[model samples]
Target: MSMTPIVLDARTLKALAHPLRVQVVGTLRRFGPSTATQLAERLGVSSAAVSYHVRQLAAAGLVVDVPERGNARERWWKAAHDVTVADTRTLDEDDPDALDAYLRSIATAITLRIQQVLGARSAMPPEWRSVTDLSDFRARLTPAQTEELTERLHAVAEEYVRQHPESEAGPDAEMVSFDLQVLPDLDVGDRS
Candidate 1:
């Protein structure tokens, strides 16, 4: 079955603005249902801290308690959806601050993830390193064309991910991360 991507609103975005909350949501998506203690061990944080962030994520509708996975004393949390879609165009025009917060939070999370991967790159095996890549491409297109390109690229990624779910990763299968960003080159017109 195909999972629908959650469309984030200003309120949900604000709730996910915290770094830990963002990490918690990512962890749930990557690792499946887990308790705060398990998440703490994976994140190298305290259980209380993980629990706090989990609550925030739950409140934001990004996560849900997996009651069947844990006893009453221990709560398990899972990501509400497999994918999260954020379109700045959907943001409320009257609330620019919320949009700014959401963008900053997303930027910080992506930057941190990239840094973490780079830090561990040297420790990875040769086979793993061979498949890793970091590249940039420039494109000149109108806003409509850019949106279409983004949708096409997203469809490709989504199809690949659906075929190979993250939860199915095994000993030999490593978690791969992909970041795709397409933006206009404002400097192109300005020689300065």
Candidate 2:
């Protein structure tokens, strides 16, 4: 499978702006192919609502229909790509509103995933629990330094996973979420 990230354009940015659609695509990517009804049950949403959003995702080419996996009763769907990128330079200049919504939706979805893991942390195996992280650090750096930091972090993160996808994972392995955000806050400690 291709590892290229889907750079959001006007059409795709608008298509994935909704929170439900964002969650749908995320679910497909994380859990693999699934039917609308199955996704609805997993997400605690109505089947009709999930179906509607899935159709929209398919229309925007963010998802694809798995005809071979489907029978007469239900249709299967999977994410078209493993990643979706919102290039701040292009999107911030072009469609800021849609860009804001799409990014916020993603942030909300990520927060939910964090919460899910937190809730299940106590029941996790000792090995997994030992490696769990929910921490942050602060630093002062120039824009160029920040860019270099991000590139280096991505390189380190991609090292182990590049050759071993979830499909090729060993029996003792489990799918994990590894998120990286290098946001620059110009207005730190300014509430107003």
Candidate 3:
């Protein structure tokens, strides 16, 4: 499967503002095609709830039905793309409120994932725990340089995924989440 990133627009960003929708899309991206019942079980929600959220995601063009994997009674859903790139720079400058809301939604989702990882850290194997990282680095660069750095980092990540396709990996290989955030420090004066 080709894992291309989907660039989200204003409308899709608004649609993904909901927490459940974010989780539904993330689940599909990580687990491949799954039915509402399977998603419900994994997410600890009801099948009906998953089905409803799946429909909302489909309407937003974030996910689609995998008819080839489903029967008459059940519908399988999969993410339309592997990665979601939300470029706040593309948002309308007049609609600062929308941009703020979208950023908040993204922050909430990231916080949730961080909490989940921290909560499960003790359960992870010794090797995995040793490799897990949480760090902060500050850098000064021009806008163009920032863009170039982000592009290079994304390309390296994509190359890694292409080389280590999960489908071809061994059973012992675990799913590792890599979250990257690069932003200018708003409180530059406060930095020590």
Candidate 4:
């Protein structure tokens, strides 16, 4: 699979500005491919509306058509990236309005995510009190090594995901959240 992050253009970002669209994308990212009917059910929206938004996402290249197991009527969609991001701070000099809108959309989506995760109930096993700790570490790395770092992180995430695939869960199980972000350790950089 290509590891390249999907660079969101202003129009594409605008397409994702709607809360429904963001939730649709998040659902696809978390659950793999899904049909509009399935997405509508999960998101508590009408299927027609979900279909319209899915088309918008497809037009923006934020989602792609996938092969279906059975009928031609089933439309499946998946997020273009494990994550979607602005990818750069350098705004297009020609379109500040679009850039501003895009930034707002990004911030709104992030804020929504934070709220969702914080409000969500944890699925701590009965022995939860005995089990977890949190911390952070700073590290230095070369630019070329960034891809390697991302892959290693994905591998670790996959290990945990494998142990608890969504299909294995009960209907009322609390969703476990995973957030991973990696950026250059700019503080240690040598400005030559």
Candidate 5:
């Protein structure tokens, strides 16, 4: 079955408000499938708590149980989506507080994960860390140029995925994360 993409309504957003749940979802998205025991071990939580949260996620339609092959007793679960989101503007205008909280939570979770990942891998492969500096610049462009640029960037990502299809998640392959968020840069003076 095709994975169901997660679109956060107010309720689902509230459901994922917890940091652990966000981490759990990210883990599932990265690892493909994991049992509660595995998650508990990874997160340093009890299996029972992991099981309970897994059920909550399943009930929220964010995750689903996948049948295990050759292991009848193992309970394997997979994320319902390859992509999950928290765009509350799609829900309603008056719920900015919920959206803000969701964004902050996701950002915090991602930042923590990045710190852990980078710290654990003291030396990244040359290819992965060849460029330690970020190149950030602003440009003035017509609407068409902006649209074309966005589409081209998206195409590059799609091509990358097509060329290097994700293998089954395991110890040999690490999940790398990329996050791009566009918001007003408060520290920067108005460029316009």
Candidate 6:
């Protein structure tokens, strides 16, 4: 049940720069095939708007119509990949605008997701709350070390997923999002 991840190229990244477009793809991927109406209902956007954005995503090859699941009245759309990944380290000055826009959109998405969990933490059962984390670590490391750490962390996560794919998860399993970011402080100024 593991789908391939889409590594962002400049064109696809630009297409996903819009926050809503990015959200549409993520929603379909996370929730499964859905029509524009269903997606709009979940995302609080108009069906027309969602349809338009879905078209844009389709054009960029990030999403596709699930014709088998669709009816004559509405088309079902799903993400072409389960994950969207970008290498911000490769971003240079040539197209800072698009790169920054895409980065901001992702940051906003992550922030909103974390906030939703935080907002609902009080109502969550003790077991779930106990497993939630909202903490950070500070360390002094070279750029190469930071990059290595990032790779190791991501590998560990990927290995875990391979071992525990969704199809095999039991009834007790929950859909979890593991958001990991390894960012270096640019302005240490003796205090980080």
Better of 1 and 5 by lDDT: 1
- Candidate number with greatest TM-score: 6
Name the regions of candidate 6 deviating beyond 4 angstroms. Answer: 89-94
Question: What would the TM-score be for candidate 4 when compared with the true structure?
Answer: 0.58
TM for every model, in the order presented, reads: 0.82, 0.90, 0.81, 0.58, 0.72, 0.91
Write candidate 2's Cα lDDT for 76-166 as tens digits. Answer: 9999998887787899899999899988988888898899999999999999999999777778788899999988998887876786677
Task: Write down the RMSD of all candidates, one decimal each.
Answer: 2.8, 2.5, 2.8, 7.0, 4.4, 2.0
- With a 3 Å backbone cut-off (N, CA, C), the pairs that clash in candidate 1 are none
Who is ahead in TM-score, 1 or 6? 6
Model 2 misplaced regions, further than 4 Å: 1-4, 186-192
Worst 10 residues of 2 by lDDT: 183-192
Off by over 4 Å in 3: 46-48, 68-73, 92-96, 170-172, 190-192
TM-score-based ranking: 6, 2, 1, 3, 5, 4
How do these models rank on lDDT, best leading?
A: 2, 6, 3, 1, 5, 4
Indicate whether candidate 1 or candidate 2 has the larger lDDT.
2
Score each candidate by Cα lDDT: 0.82, 0.89, 0.83, 0.72, 0.72, 0.86
Q: Model 3 — TM-score against the truth?
A: 0.81
Q: Local error of candidate 2 at 181, Å?
A: 1.7
Scored against the true structure, residue 97 in model 5 reaches a CA lDDT of: 69
Candidate 6, run of 10 with poorest lDDT: 87-96
Better of 1 and 3 by TM-score: 1
* Candidate 3, 55-133: lDDT as tens digits: 9889988899898899999999999988888777777563556667767766777788889889999999999899999
Q: Which is better, 2 or 3, measured by TM-score?
A: 2
